[model samples]
Target: MNLLSKFATVGGATLVSRIFGFVREMLMASALGIGPVADAFNLAFRFPNLFRRFFAEGAMNSAFVPLFSKALEEKGEAAARDFATQVFSFLTVVLFALTVPAIIFMPFLVRTVIAPGLNVCIDEAALQQALSCEDRFGITVAFSRIMFPYLASMSLVAMVGGILNAYRRFFAAAAAPALLNVVLIGVLVWALWDGQDTRALGFAMSWGVLVAGVAQFVMVTVAMRMAGFSVALRRPRWTPDLKRLLVLAGPAALIGGITQINLFVGQAIASFKPGAVSILTYADRPYQLPLGMVGVAIGVVLLPELSRALKGGRLDEAQHTQNRSLEFALFLTLPAAVALFIIPEPIIRIIYERGAFTPSTTAAVAAVLGIYALGLPAFVMIRVFTPGYFAREDTRRPMMVTMASAGANTVLSVALFYVMAEQGIALATSLAGWLNALLLFHGLYSRNLWIVDRSLVKRCCLLLLCAALMGGVLLLLMPLLSHWIQPGAGIGVQVLAIGILVAAAVASYFALCFVTGAADRQMISRMLAARRKRGARNA
Candidate 1:
């Protein structure tokens, strides 16, 4: 398949997952609102999710894919399978070690790292403490313990998914995440049906997370077996291969998990205020749809593609891949960033303003989502550029850059959250994301690893203008549709309004792309022609 086709396979699946996630979040907002239960549940889930990113998506994908790709390209599938098995065994042992300790130390983690602000309300009113902080704290700890096993399951999923991705089997792993949202939505539906309280719902969802993790792990493992690559259990050995994987994975942990690290930092700081964590979490979901579809698809596809190209000494192909990936990222993301920045309120209101989620809460979440939109491209660029470094087996530099970005985010979040509240934290995360993206881009350029091609520069400029023009159109359109999108509108009307707004925005942006010659029609025709030729040959 072509590059864009491969991207679509992953991205399309991610789009499905994000749509389900939106439903899940809406249910949570309706059921729990931004109250203690919401705060506790969000914090509890974020803890394991933080580690899942650190281990599974971040370290495992970054460190494992290239090595697996190399082994497949050079040493053949048997050797690659053997290598995967070794890593699997090691990862199993490590996750067991990590989960057992984390569950045992759940309370301490909740009080200190998960939500330190719970212990001492910085606000003079002590509103946070008055809101049964001790009870919320205990709930967070218990919920965290119930869900901690998810980390192990997802980490293993990553290992298996990495193997599938290396074999260019992207669908299974990409679709696996949808199960988490599916499972959670089922739990929410059941809870809502049974009229369960927020506390009961929280516990149910925590267990749902564990169940979803196991489901995801099983799905990917089954896919691997079907792909003729079964990774059997083996004695964990400290061979050179295992040692090498460790060396590469260590620094990569930071590089891969930069977004999660920033979010963790923001969550920690946002914890000082009651409902702030939930507010930020709610705000975070809207922008994540675009990020997951564009940024994640590029990251997953680019790493293996670039690794194989580099391993086979295909420099031009590798360079072209990076350029196209960046171009593709901006093409989708720029418009999304602009639309979200322009119309977050309607989106948030339609999605979350049903039950305990009030108009005021919608406003709060919208503001944060707007600021996050500003950094959306930077966040995706980090995903696009990091592969350039990892494909070449240079993780330390990106790791250093990641650490610096995290430090900036921490310092900025701490300083800003005090002043601007949740919006300040959002701004800090965006600023830090830009810093991370720029450094990665510069590193690639300065080292002669990647050069900014003229086509990319031209298309990016055009896409930016296109996005701005689309934003202007949205600015003009929203007021006319305000009646339907306003807080008191019927849910069906609100949904229809958003659908109309998105359709118009997307229509205008792509129309502008073709009009401005930003989108290469000839290249698209060639891809189509290539696919037709392949189909004919198979026939």
Candidate 2:
């Protein structure tokens, strides 16, 4: 498949997953809102997610995909499958060892690492009377223990996903996340129907997480087997291949560890405030949509593609792929960033300001969303640039850079939380993202691995111009549509108004891009036409 075709397959699946994820989060908002239950759930959910990023998405996939793709290219299916099986065995052993201890020490971890602020009991009587900080802490510990096994399942899912992506099977791998959302949404609906209490609902949600992880793992494993790469579990052994994998995974894991630590720091600091964690999480959901659809899709596809190109001595193709990926990422992400920055309030209100979620909550979440939007482009660009290093099997530099970024994030998040509250934490994360992106970009450019072509540069400029125009249009239109998006409005009216606003922004952005020659109408038309023909032939 061509780059855009592969991107479309992966991106389209991710788009579906992200949409379902929004539904899941919206339900979560209504079910839990920004109280102790909501805060506790967010904290609990974050524990497993933090580890999943560290092990599965970050370290494992980064090391596995390129190596696995090279094995497929150089050796054959048999050799590749053997490598995958070995890695799987080793990973299974490691994750099992990790998960047990993590579950056992959940309370200690929650008290110390995850949310030390939750342990504080100053003004205990008032806290007990109002939010019940101690109760929230205990619930967070319980929920975290229930959800911790997801790390193992998702890590295996990521490994299987890497194998599938290497085989150019992106859809099932990308679509696996949607299953998690679907399962969670189902559980949410069932719990609501049963009229469960907050603690019971939290337990149900935690169990849903575990079930979804297993479901996702099963889906990807079946897909991988159908693709003729079944990874039968075997006793772990220290083979040379396993050693090489570990060697590469070590630094990559450090990078992932650093990145997750940055996140933990932000969340930890936010936890000190009464509802800051939930507020930041709610605000994070919309930006995650574009990040997942654009950044993650590009990264997943780009890594294996770059590895294959470099393996075949296709330097020019690799460079072109990198450039095009950057251009495409910016093309989609810039407009999203602009829209989020311009219309966070209306967007948050339409999606979340109902049930227990209030107007004040929407305003707070919107403010965090706006700050996060500032970092959206930077975050996407990090995904684009990091593959340049990973494809070259250079994880150490990224790890070092990540350390600096994480340190900065820690310092800034702590410093700013007292000043800007939750928004400060969000702002710190954005600034850290920019710093990380800049460092990655410089690393690539300095090594002459990723030199931007003039055309790519011009297109990026045009994308920025279009995004600015879209932002201006939104600014002008938002006031006129404010009444329709107010908290008091009916759900249908709010949805319709938000939909109209989004459509208008997207239309104007594309129109501006076309008028400015940033995007060529003829090129897009030809590409779509070609894709259709290819599809027909396959059919």
- For lDDT, the strongest prediction is 1
- lDDT score at residue 308, model 1, on the 0-100 scale: 87
**Candidate 2: which stretches are off by over 4 Å?**
122-131, 254-260, 520-523, 534-539
Find the 10 residues in a row with the least total lDDT in model 1.
121-130
Residue 301 shift from truth in candidate 1, angstroms: 0.4
Error of 1 at 250 (Å): 1.1
Candidate 1's C-alpha runs over 4 A off are: 121-131, 526-539
- The alpha-carbon deviation from the true structure for residue 233 of candidate 1, after best TM-score superposition, in angstroms, is 1.4
Encode model 1's per-residue lDDT on 421-525: one tens digit a residue.
999999999999999999999999998999779999999999999999999989898889989998778989999999999999999999999999888777677
lDDT of 2 by residue, 317-424 (tens): 999999988888988999999888888888898788877788888999999999999999988888788778888889889988988998899999989999999999
What TM-scores do the predictions have?
Answer: 0.96, 0.96
Clashes of each: 0, 0
Q: Report model 2's TM-score to 2 decimal places.
A: 0.96
Q: What are the Cα lDDT values of the candidates?
A: 0.90, 0.85
Model 1 lDDT vs. the true structure?
Answer: 0.90
